[model samples]
Target: MICIMLVVAVVTTPGTSMASVKMEPLARTAPPPVEFKIQGSFDPSNSYLDQGTATISDNGNQTVKISVITEAKSSVASIGGTVYLQKWTGTQWINVGSASTISASNDWYFSGEVVKPAEQGYYFRARVVHWINHNGVYEQGETTSDSRLVS
Candidate 1:
């Protein structure tokens, strides 16, 4: 036979009302190790990306600038990605403009200004997919910037 116990206590404070509180024992469970979980064929440690960043700023003239910076661990055959300018339409994010570039270097930076005549009062952000091709292996990473209101 198993027994479960519960404790009840009355708590009071100075110049305050008194309330009854119930205390119960907590049940804890250990989580499975990461290696035991089933993952896809992609290995996370094989990525050559060092850092990726995206930014959006108001240009003060009915336009916003979206920028992206992608850095790799070392010089590769090709490095580039696509930058997408997105706008929040009360419920979902929609892409407004996009730019893609490819260069043979370790670091790549790109920026574009989008005219927002129809989306003046919406929130906007920048999303970038930074990729690198090194030793016949292709790896990519994504990053998103903080949202800003287009004025």
Candidate 2:
């Protein structure tokens, strides 16, 4: 479970007018998310799915930013997987157009933007598949992230 703590303290002068404020991350801890589950077919060496995260931001003109962080075990890459960005309809989850191929490397971070309905609430999530070794015996490990609502 990834835990993030952000604390910002703003001090202003009596006669000064502040136009902008910049705040850096106070404390950030990235533990394996509780929602990520590994299937039995996956190898133990690449089982842990750490730093799986998703977020959406509005940039006006009906544009929404979607981001996902796929890291396993340590900060470096430990597995290869396919990261999918999906959107939930009223009844079912549908795959969006954006799909990222995460090759085994040191930490994989993917971000994309889509034009969605403005001011309408929708659920979004990331689905990742950890591809086992490329040897003759290959097994796939899969996991889905908890949904986040974006309006």
The best candidate by TM-score is 1
TM-scores for candidates 1 onward, in order: 0.59, 0.43
Candidate 1, residues 65-90, lDDT tens digits: the string is 66666666666766765677777766
* Total backbone collisions, model 2: 2
Worst 10 residues of 1 by lDDT: 25-34
Residue 142 in model 1: lDDT: 79
Whole-model alpha-carbon lDDT for candidate 2 = 0.49
Among these predictions, the greatest lDDT belongs to 1
Candidate 1's TM-score: 0.59
**Per-residue alpha-carbon lDDT of candidate 2 for residues 1-151, written as tens digits (9 for 90 to 100):** 9999999877987765566543332212222234444432344555444334444555443345544344455434334556676666655667776666645544434233333342335555666665533224344555565655443
TM-score of 2: 0.43
